[model samples]
Target: MRAYNETWIENKNVVSQAERWHRRSLLTDDQLTAVRKAYPVGFQTMNGFLEIGLFIFTIIATGGVFLLFVELLSIDDSSIFGLYCLLFGIGLAILNNVLIRRRQFYRNGVDNALVMATTALMVGGFNSQFLDDGSLWQWCLVALPLLAAVVWYYGDTLITFIALAVLYTCLFDLTLEASFGRTLLPFVGMVVSGLLMQATRMIRQRAYYDDAVSLTQWVALAMLLVSVNYYVVRETNWLLIRSTLRRSGVMSPPEIDLPWLFWLLTVGLPIGYLWQGFVRKNRMLIILGVLGVAAAVATIRYYVGILPLNVHLTLCGLFLIGIAVGGIRYLRSSRYGFTDVPDEDSPDEFLISSDVITAAQVAAGTSGHDQHDNVKFGGGKFGGGGAGGGYN
Candidate 1:
């Protein structure tokens, strides 16, 4: 179901781990080189900045070509235009496949851009042709499957996010028509996000889906917090109520039902997240928990106005700094597998090294070179250099 070689993906993981070990002084330079040779990742990738630039260029080029083709053919009819879009989208999808299989383009900008363009054109074409008068949920329904298929094939994190958004839209839209839709909406979101988090946790051990699953877990955690957030629930409910009231010629300030419940959820959810995060030692949860607390504070200040804005912000900043200082001091000696010091075994070390090396290479004007060249730090074989050899 995947486009890239599974072995290559596994090898990429091995190389990343090896790179981390080498940075930690666990593996010598020669051993790192041997590891890279043993587990070669043949995917053609680019530096982060270059990837973004190329991605933008590919999108512009593809869109320009499509427009030029349409103009040259004088195709103006809506249905005809839709057909052309579908055709172009299919062509781009094929091109994407060719790039991945034949050219060995992995998450490089060109492939990423092609995949994105293909999804957009396909959805837009379908909408223009058959769903012109359809509701937004219908459009979302059309996109959900397409996005899921793309995720299955490419395992792209951005595409996964888009798919999750579409899925949530469809879920919420469908629920909105139920007898007590608005009241059930938040609970529904929470339940779905929780289930998704659980599923991702179960499957995240798989190397092929690791990145996608990890991102999904983070998103799910955030959604779980947002599902019952006071500000979101109040604003969204009021918007719905305002529309209904205006339709019925009733103009009054809309009030939310079960305000106390939302308030409790807003205050309690973050604490719960923080507790679970620490107990489980999950970094995503901890980060989201901190963010959730900040959001809750802002929500409270927006309504309560206990202190001046500047004063509140200053207090919050100082409080956070104090916590940071205290935590660092407390964790200096390590506690329950947690520490303030950097962990050499952490994957972040390898990522940081990769970024630094890529930046250095770019600054040195040595970004372009043959893959067969023996560069430093396992270059041309692993650790950000172009990996050679055919995909199995």
Candidate 2:
């Protein structure tokens, strides 16, 4: 908080917030007390309750504005749409800049969501401007570098995930469309991307990479799981030759039985993820592994309906229960990764806790990091890691 003028002192509210920021760092104690003493009374009550509602309000406000345009303007021209997207992008970028100028970047709870929404606007503008042809959405791939550069430069942690998601989507579509980029390539790509995020974070941890690392982990995991799940359901044998011929109008896509590899991966990959997750204490992998197991079973049951649903479900429930009981019994005197993890403040596990201040934690809690860094707290090796640690 740079003091731009002497009024910064007369304006005790900002001083108090600045002190709060200092406390969050957990650096000094007496300095905080002295600052509070100088600026006591007429406490600047931040409308945090109102701030909570602001997210919903921001979303609705954006939609309302767009809706008004659609309803009142009767603008159906594509050029007009392009103009609107460009104008909206410019407007949102300016608005975010305004907030930054007001020093509300980290202060306002709604800033992140607002900025992410703006990202969509910017991407829309890019699409309207560049993707004028009505071709496969694959053209969106060109926007990847542009959006990635913008997000990297903009320095919004939340936007990183969106950018990465777009990147992955393009990769997936391009791979699926092409004959060569099939089978295990996309799956490997996703898993590698996730692992790289973990590895990079470990090597270059810092305060700036917090949200980007946390959010992208989930997105990468999702891509991995979806790719693996698709492999379980379908066969990719001779895809290149087949797709090549089909593209040249030589043959149509053939109907074929599920490959042996599909079943092998369906059962094997899930167990592998589960085992790795348990041993490595990687919750993301464990979760994907557990869900993978269920999906594998469901896929099997969907294709093979020899038994009644009730009977299959009963057997599954009993099997899961047996595993739970045996596992719990085996580890009763010991410990498991998830067994000792403390509960987070947010029920929405997707959200960052420190970024979110519950009424209780807000009133009673002292300043501290959101405990998002896994190395600083409880987490698996691949989980959200501690930042600010220098790379070796």
Candidate 3:
């Protein structure tokens, strides 16, 4: 189902676990090296800065070549231009596949850039060539399947986000055109987002798909909140209604139906998310919950301006600081598998200092038996550790 090598993916996961163990001081330097040598990952990757630089470079290079081709051919017609774009997109897609299969590029900038360009070109070309009088929703309908296919093949997080966005746009536009659409749109969005959230949650966890699935789930959660958010519902409804009224030559202020229901959702959804976050101990949910709360506050301030913006912001900041300080203090002792203390075993910590690991490895090699004797063995989240086969 995936384009990348399965064995390499498994090896990459093993290496990740080994790195975590080494960071936690549960794996000896020698053991870490042994694990690395035993399970090798062939995927070509880059550091964050390099990846971004290469991504930009790839886009620029490809765009330049495309423009040069268009200039040389002197293609001016929309149909011809669309045909060229389709050809270019197909070429890029093939190149992407070649890079992945032959060079084992995974999340590397070249592959990422190619996939993105391919998607954009294909969608643009299709719209230009085939949909002369089509609506925006119709265009989005065309894009949704292409984006979904790209996501399934590449499992790119950004592509997944684009796919979700297209899906949302399609739904929104379609629903807005229906009978009683203004009244039903928000609820429809809520229902679809809720179903999407559940679907993502039930997907079988795999290394290749994990990031995409997580991103989809997060987007679904956000969409669900936005669907019921008072400001969003009211503003969007007003805008649509205003447009319709302008078309009909009727200038009247729009009023939302069931303002009370929207208000309840605006206040209640955030609290629900916050409670669910704490209960599930999900960091993404907690962060979204905090944002939801901010949105709710903003909505209130938008409608009813009792306090000044600066005063409201200052109070919110102070309240947040107080909560953070109190929560940290409360979680200092580590209750219910949660703590204020940072995990030494975290993957982020592992990436921070390769030199430290090298120095420790050198010291271990020099001290030999003494270092082995001094090594601590204990129960860890990974397993009872001494690096022997704990990672295995």
Model 3 TM-score on a 0 to 1 scale: 0.84
Clashes of 2: 1
What C-alpha lDDT does candidate 2 achieve relative to the native structure? 0.55
- lDDT tens string, model 2, 1-392? 22112232233433435444663675375665555455442222244455468666777887788768767888788777867877776786677666655643442445555666666776776677667884444555766676666555454555665567666666666666665556545455656676856765675644344455655665565455545543322434345457676777856444334466556766787788789888997866766677667766776666665878778878878998998888767765656445532333223331543344333224433222223233321223222211111010
- Model 3 is weakest, by summed lDDT over 10 consecutive residues, at 366-375
Worst 10 residues of 2 by lDDT: 383-392
Model 2 spans > 4 angstroms off: 1-52, 63-77, 100-109, 153-161, 176-203, 230-258, 335-392
Report the lDDT tens digits of candidate 1 across residue range 1-392.
67777787887777666755776799997886687678767666466677889899999999899999999999989999999998999999998888888877877888999989998898889789888888778889988888888888888877987888888999999889788998899889999999998888676376676667876776677778788777778778777778877888867545577889888988898889889989998666676677777777777776776788778868877998999999999999999989988774444554556666455334433322111111111211111100111100
Off by over 4 Å in 1: 244-253, 344-352, 355-392
- What RMSD does each model have against the real structure? 9.1, 9.7, 10.1
Give all candidates' CA lDDT scores: 0.75, 0.55, 0.75
lDDT of 2 at 375: 30
Clashing pairs in 2: 205-388
* Residue pairs of candidate 3 with colliding backbone atoms: none
Please give the TM-score that candidate 2 achieves against the real structure: 0.63
